[model samples]
Target: MDPRIDFLYLSEPDMIAAGVLDAKRCVEVCEETFALLGKGDYLMGGANHNNHGMNIVFPKETKFPNMPVAGPDRRFAAMPGYLGGRFDVCGNKWYGSNHANIEKGLPRSILTMMLNDKETGAPLALMSANLLSAARTGGVPGAAARHLVNKGAKVVSVVGCGPINKACFTAIMTQLEGVEKVVCFDLFLDKANEFARWVQGEYGVGAVGVDDTEAGFRDADVITVAASRLRPLYFEDEWIKQGATILVSGPFNTDESFLTSARIVYDHTALQEAYVEDAIASGNKEAYYSGVIGGPFFRLIDAGKLPALKDSTSLGDVVNGAKPGRADLKERVIFIACGMAVFDISWGFELLQNARARGIGQSLNLWERPHQG
Candidate 1:
């Protein structure tokens, strides 16, 4: 065995230097990962091997005197998974989040990932995962954009112009051409305007802030919703034009007609089943899935409109050539991007491998010998 072992430390800047924000590459890596997922070469937590993992929730009222008070989006979670094919590795992303961080001018979530040795359960890299998480989160839909949307999708309406959506918008722009107009909508108009300027400056596309969400959706050939709203989705189906593709990266709401007619797709059916499992386990299906874009589909199944949950197709199948992405250009498709940890690991693994080859990131060595007898 080698006498010494060192893992690279990737700060945010190091991640940038290592091409962590390159959505184009992240999308490609995710494409491969999805292909593998379609082939059943992956394992996530839970009885179905597809669970999204258990999220730690906080109480509004704390019993412990010294415990921190609960706030919105304030919780901790551990997402663990393993990929099988060529990139046979296992790991987890652990993080604590607080929506109140914005009051302190900080991001809502602070995340980190540990790449592990498959056999020994040792960490290969303790790396910053903000960009890693953001890119993979955005890149999945960007890959969907490649397959689902029409060839000449000129207009893209961004429902949420936050950091994650920024990554999503940029990545879709890379694959799409003649995307001259970008319409943005956010509860905070200033953030939307700021996003507009950034998009215009970065991609040379025309960015405009629209007061009406429906107006933003009308002319858009592609729509991406990445807001942080927790309530039921209120976006009306009347707002979405025919022949448009909707990529939901955040929680959303839709009508019964749209839910029944539109082809409901998922990044992975198991991930959503994981949500159902969680709902059944916690007896809170209505609370968690009710307002979500996918929530309406579950409602339809309950209402006997759509088929069972198992009937939906996985995006990986579309990517792997087993199923078609857009059956016809006029078909309206709704893809709920329930993010998976394997995606982060898959792209993170590729980036780490690339960084090692290109000599990117800083390296630190652990102790030379074992501390315990």
Candidate 2:
């Protein structure tokens, strides 16, 4: 065997050329990844194998002048996982996020990903992952929309007008047909109008910005909450249409009543359970509710107010044909996504393969020889 080692480096444009922005394909791969998760063919960080990942957080007060202080959406995180199936690859996504970055004309989170050979532990590729992450994040809801959305769904309600939701809208429009209009709401009306105009120009759909959050939900067939909220926003059950499907990609957007009344589905049950376990062990059960999108439901389960794990179903089960999706037109469904590292690994592996096929990325030498072992 050759002892020389090299790896591919893909920039954002290289990734796009390698089909990283193909929303429909991303959804298909995400569905397959979920099926593998259902079959127990994946390993994430932590001993339980379901941990989200390791996050580095700073304290609110620091004695050191150079040390960063805690603020909104500020932290460093490393999400590592190994996925097994047709694509057996290990990878980690590293990101530093600060909400204040927006003022400097940068995204809140800037990410990079590294894929490895599972057996040999050698680097295969290092790629810019902002688009990869957003596409996979949006693909979860796209997959849900494919399986759970009612037929002839005409209107889509979008709560947040950020880059993440832009990817989500692209995926949704690609997967679902007959989407006629988009009703959008944001804390900044200017942002909402800007996103609406983009949707109109990109998808050729009617887009409208609403001043009221409730107005955005009226008569909508699908609702997506991608807004950045530091506190919970309660929605009256009456505000939601009977057949509407709500996709939540952020924290504290809905309340316990809506969750209890809806047919709740999660990307994965064990991951959320792991969050609950961590919160309890840390002696702050309330943090689970405040920190996670599905935390309130889990808190209710802990309090015995809701059935333990019975009132909800896993999206993987639905994907694997073990459970049904959207049984009736009037059944309101809520999909809560906590964002998995397996998705990044899966999509990154595919992008790397595509880059190799298309001869798109730069090749960098890792070592001239195997110096150790």
Candidate 3:
């Protein structure tokens, strides 16, 4: 047998060429992945097998001069997983994030993805993951929006106007019909205005930039929050229109009344289970989920104000028809997305196939043969 180990290296442009920018297709791929997740056909890091990823968790203070202290969205994490159900591939996405990178002309979170063979553990592909991650991140909520958003939703509010939300907005646009207008909310009016211009040009929707946070919520049929970590967007229950669905992919802060009353859904229950356990283990029960979009919901659960995580319907189960989504038009629903590696591995697997079929990516040899075998 030819004992050569080879893998594909896909650069950013190559990934784009492989249709990574096809938001509609990415959403379909995410839908399939979620169904697989609902079937219990996936493996991720940690004993629970559903961890989002493991973080470096830098200390708040360090004696050593070279050691880094934690900053906003600053951490390194390795997110690994194996996805089954026609994918049957193993992979991981490496995440390095620091908000300071913006000053250096770099993205806050620099990411790369690796795919391996399930049986042999041999490398299959290594590719740039910024777009891949963004697409899948957006695709999850996009998938949720399909089953959760109220019909004839006309206005979409984006809470964060950064690149992540840009990708999310793109994916969401593919699912929502008759979205006549887009309202972008951001701390910087210029950034919001720029994003609004892009939305108007790209999606042909009426777009406006709003400095007021309430404008992002009122009269909007769907609101997607992807604001930076720890930077929570807050609003009153009265601000959210009846039947509005909040798709939270980043930090959010709101009243307990909203949490207690809304029709809450999650990307996947198991991952959040891991998150809750991890947070409890940290000994600071309330610190971790503080500003996170879904954190407060978990907090209420711990306080016994909400149902157990198992009782809440997962977006996956809804996608697979095992549970319900948006039962009534007036149901105020909130779908919290705690980022997961399965989406990255699964989507990367799909794109790797496309790269292979189209003869894209560079083939490189890992070794001529095994050293001892």
Candidate 4:
């Protein structure tokens, strides 16, 4: 057997060429990944095997100047996981994020993904992952929309108006047909208008920008939240239409009137439970819960107001046919996912195969052969 190891290196353009921007395909792969996750065929970071990742968070006050102090959205995270089924591999999504990156003409978070061999530790591919991450992040909700959305959904309300939501819109539009309009809302009207115009240009949908958050939700069939964490986006019970699906990927706030009636679906229940366990053990459960999109529901679970974590429905279970997506029409539903590494690994594995098949990326040799040999 050849001892030499060479790994594929895919840059941003290569990733796009390799089909990383295919939201429909991303959703399909994410659905398969979710099924694997539901069948207990994956392992994430930490002992729980459901941990999101290990984050290097600098403190607010550090005595040494070289040791950087914490600022807005500054940290490094290593998310590692192994996925099973057709694509069985291990991988990690490593990223550095800082709110100040805009000053340097960089993205808030720059990411890369490394896929590895199951038996050997050598990498299969190392690729730029900004588009990969966005596609998967959007794909989860897109998958949820596939199984859970109300039939003939006509209008979609997009809150946040960021690039992530652009991908979400693409995936959802790919799955759900007859989408006639898109309402875009953001902290800045210019951003919202820009998103609306893009939607109109791409999909020929009657897209419009809205200044009022509530106005964005009115008469909408789907509401996607991927907004700022600094302030949780809140909605009134009256503003939301019946049978509307809310896909939350960021901070959110709404009254109990909606929660008591809405069926809350998780991306993966085990990960959220692991997060809850970690929070309780951290001795700051409230603050911990506050940091996540699912915090409100998880806190309610902790208080016994909501059902137990096991009792909750996950998108994975729905995909696996282990659980129903929706019980009845006119029952408002919310799907919340905090993101996971298995998604990156699965998609990365797929892109690697695609790129290899098409010979779309650079290949670098690790060694001619083992030095000892």
Q: Which residue pairs collide in model 2, if any?
A: none
* 1-373: candidate 4 lDDT, tens digit per residue: 8888999999999999999988999999999999999999999999989999999999999889899789889999999999999988999999999999989999999999999998999988899999999999999898889999988899999989988888887888888888888899988899999999998889887999987888877789999989876666888888888889999888887887788678889999999989988898889999988887788897777777899988888898999899998888888889998999999998888899999999899999999888885
Worst 10 residues of 1 by lDDT: 227-236
Write down the lDDT of every candidate, Cα atoms only.
0.82, 0.87, 0.90, 0.90
Return whichever of 2 and 3 wins on TM-score.
3
In model 2, where is the ten-residue run with the lowest total lDDT? Answer: 228-237
Candidate 3's C-alpha runs over 4 A off are 63-65
Clashing pairs in 3: none
lDDT of 4 at 367: 93
Clash totals for all candidate models: 1, 0, 0, 0
**RMSD of candidates 1 onward, in order:** 1.7, 1.5, 1.3, 1.2
**Residue pairs clashing, model 1:** 233-253
Kindly indicate the candidate among 2 and 3 with the higher lDDT. Answer: 3
Report the C-alpha displacement of residue 37, candidate 4, in angstroms.
1.1
Give the per-residue Cα lDDT of candidate 4 at 320.
88
> Which digits, one per residue and each the tens of the lDDT, describe model 2 over residues 28-63?
999999999878899999989999999999999999
The sequence of per-residue lDDT tens digits that candidate 3 reaches over residues 99-145 is 89999999888999999999989999999999999999999899999
Highest TM-score scorer? 4
